[model samples]
Target: MFPFKMSEGNPNDGPTPQPANPTSPCPCRDDTKGTQRYETKEQEADSAQESCYSLFTVTQKRWIVFLVAAAGMFSPMSSFIYYPAINSIASGLNTSVELINLTITSYMAVSGVVPTVVGNAADGLGRRPIYILTMLIYLVANIGLALQNSFPALLVLRMVQSAGSSGTISLGYGVISDITTPAERGSYVGLLLLGPNVAPPLGPIVGGVVSSKLGKLLDSDYASVARTHGLEVNRVFGDDLRNFPIEKARLRSVFYIIMGASLSILAYGWLLCFHVHFSAPLVMQFIIGATSTAIFTILGALLTDINSSASSTAAASANVIRCALAATGLAVVETMVQKIGPGWCFTIFSGITAAMGPLLLLERERGLGWRNKIYQGNGGSG
Candidate 1:
């Protein structure tokens, strides 16, 4: 029933605005008040603007950017962590330090080369599976290194390890592109720069401890056996068994330690594959691998997202070129360090890598200008 009846001579046949009400039933609402409709074009536009603004809120956008940048850091962390252990590894295996250094060089070479080839594969194959597989490969390689006695085997395994590990770093950028807008991309890009820059100092410190302390522990039993033999004590365990008794126990203990370490690595790898949760230090190297992989993946995704939303193909191509140039410069620096000494090389290269942080800051400032222009042009069209 109508709340108000129209008089026969009412001027209500023409369009008339409804009276504003404090608590009256809205004309926009149905009887149940479960649904409402926008009656004017202005109302629809206002609703859409609010939604867009909500979606691009400063806090949400900053986190998305942060995650992407964190992802990019993994690659450099994973790559640099093993450099300090090269000389110790060489001594343990009775090989020359130069030969061990080649393994490091080869690993770097593989990392640099594999990403270019796999970058396309990642776009086609998707991100999660490739990342899991790469982590597994890295886990296996570390296990192999711990167990292996031969230099050739180590070399080949290092290559395989690097091939798998490097793919995630490259694919991460692409994933970021899928998620972020162009105007917001530079912050994410800056995060990617943090990975390589921050890793060098951290990597070497860990590497130094592992190589020095662990290496000494590993060789202690052998050193003890040599000393005992000079004192006319039997190094051999028993008359029946040909092996040294104390040495055998030490070897068994070594095997147990290696086995424990290997299992920890495997467990983390499985966790990564199955998306299980884990803590660090308990798993040590695996934790490093996971953290590094995750960081790189996140940053890559942010970069990709920004590029996809905001950049033309030409602009994206320019970014790639810039990345390549930076890599080339790094290579030249690395070569100089190899010729001089690692200490000087690392110091200089570390400085260069650190400089990336400031570069990212500058780029982020520039990106804001570009973002405004794009938004203005889009607004003008609308």
Candidate 2:
């Protein structure tokens, strides 16, 4: 600077500053040594900050868990919603209540059994395809049930429906396990269980209202409209009514309505398979079934997450804790259903299920602290 600024020297010339020795600590360091150490400390601080930010971003993950949980709920909703409609079904099909009961039993049995088989398939084939296939089968079976007049046809279709619908539960849990970390698994799993737990009770309530109203409208006993339409009266009630000749116009109208609904559902199912948009009894059933399916899948996924995070010795213990929580939830739902009826059961369950979203935020905070402790321990060991 002196040479450049001085008038006697060349204007472009300047003294060069000496290079600092790489081994020498800067004067800025009070210790006057180990500058590399301070640099490393700064780097570590930056890394830690980045890690903290990454772990804190769990809101998206929680939403994924919720969706998967919702999908899992659909299976139970589809199966149980029709429970209240059984008598109407029996009447319409010219079948005994016992046969309808058998259908219900078969539906339940298949739902329970098929999931185990499909669970393996889900693991092999992956969640998306399995979910699409399951929903499609369900849609087809429902449509078939709506169209078919024969009891045997109904039974077979019902079986197929259960088989396709049941896979959702297990696969849903599998998806959850994929996304969530171990420390945060429990809360999501609990939320997943909440869907189906609520479905049984809510289904019957809606089913009862719809079935009763539909039965009334379809019945020959109604006064003004019955006479207006010139509908025939059968002396026998319920099954006996099926044997009576339904007016051609009335039968055609009913068939049209059923087929129309079935077609709409079929169209929607195709959309779902292709990941396209669709529209409420049809979409509602899918939603409920999907939610239930997702819940079970999330449960399994959360289990896997938990297993991965814990030590081998602690894995069994972790599983026990999870199972206990699940058992407790099941017991609570069972008790509630028994004490207050299925309608309230679902209401309470849904409330609890929805509540899990917030719980995930809390768990994430606690999980971060726990993970820090584990990290610290590992570092100390190293």
Candidate 3:
């Protein structure tokens, strides 16, 4: 069995204990998941000193998930909140709408890159400290955004805001993995995704509504002991962090879902770019949002599974793909649309996503072997 640091009870008893009554709650048992497999008896014995499940109770874990989801909202909220106000900011700065969009590109660019550092730190230094630090950074950036007068200030501060807000995602996944079991992970995934998926559609709507009225605004592990403490570990992902075929672990399950999202993006782009019926684009938005959310949810859960010990780092690396690709795309989208028009633009973007289907399928087939090879190389038995 893949060993998570589960409390096996009294060693003298010879078996993991069970709850006395079928109807009674089991200590440290919850509906979600996390785990690690150790190769040595000494290592396993060391792990046994920790909690059987998570350090936190079911109620505590649920609350942590909810809080993390709430925190996750800030990133999307800040980005979309500024959308409707773009024209106003542009006009006030005596700049073009295009330039205003650059601030967004900058925010996304920083959002993509900052997590590498934050994820590493969270895994090593512990989640609570990192959480408090990032939130403060984010809060200050938000305040600056609310008060900034120049485009430069806005651009710089948005990146600052992104730096603060983006790490929450990686952190949440780590926390989820800490408290959850793989078998029960999906249920918590929905809750974990509540902010990310729910925020986008609502973000712009919220942004549009709020910006129209006011303005813009928003790992794992060290699994064993960290799980027992209801926090992240005070260590890094180790020499093998970059060596694993993480791309395969992350994208394999989502290959078809990506294609679906690509199609959805294409359709949404067509509706928005062309003079389509109002509700048509709205419907496409829903479709695209749902599809994209599927990609995030699936990939997030899978990465957590693969990097059970260093889930935060895994989630952070995943963000690099999601945010970096988005930043790259956003950087060029307007220029592409200007040169080719919406239909062709959507076609190109959709094609970009669709092209991945083959690689991802290959990932699905060979990913396990690749991961095992990494483990074998590291003197670990998969």
**TM per prediction:** 0.43, 0.43, 0.69
Model 1: ten consecutive residues of lowest lDDT: 235-244
**Candidate 1 vs 3: which has more TM-score:** 3
Could you give candidate 2's per-residue lDDT for residues 1-382 as a string of tens digits? Answer: 2222233467666554433564554467566456668888999987766544123246776676567656766777887688899899999988899999888767766765677666666676777887788889988998998899998998888889888877665665676555543324445555555555556765433443343233233332223333455644322111111222222212222333333333443444344345544453456454444343333333233234433322221222333454456556755867765787645555555555555544544443354355456657888331
Q: Residue 29: error of model 2 in Å?
A: 31
Q: Write the per-residue lDDT of candidate 1 for residues 1-382, one digit (tens) a residue.
A: 2244344566766544454553576666555333433355667877766544134455664575455335444556666777778787888889999898888777767766667656655566765666676678777887886788899998998888777666554555654454433323334443444444456675433443333233234234434543564422321210111222222212322333333434444444444444444554335554343333332322333334334432223223433554466567666855764586444544454344345445444543454455556657888331
Off by over 4 Å in 3: 1-51, 91-99, 147-151, 203-256, 266-275
Where does candidate 2 have its weakest 10-residue lDDT segment?
Answer: 235-244
Candidate order by decreasing TM-score? 3, 1, 2
Q: In model 3, how large is the Cα lDDT of residue 72?
A: 84
lDDT of 3: 0.70
lDDT (CA) per prediction: 0.50, 0.54, 0.70
RMSD of each: 23.9, 23.5, 15.5
Candidate closer to the true structure by lDDT (higher is better), 2 or 3: 3
Poorest 10 consecutive residues of model 3 by lDDT? Answer: 212-221
lDDT of 2: 0.54
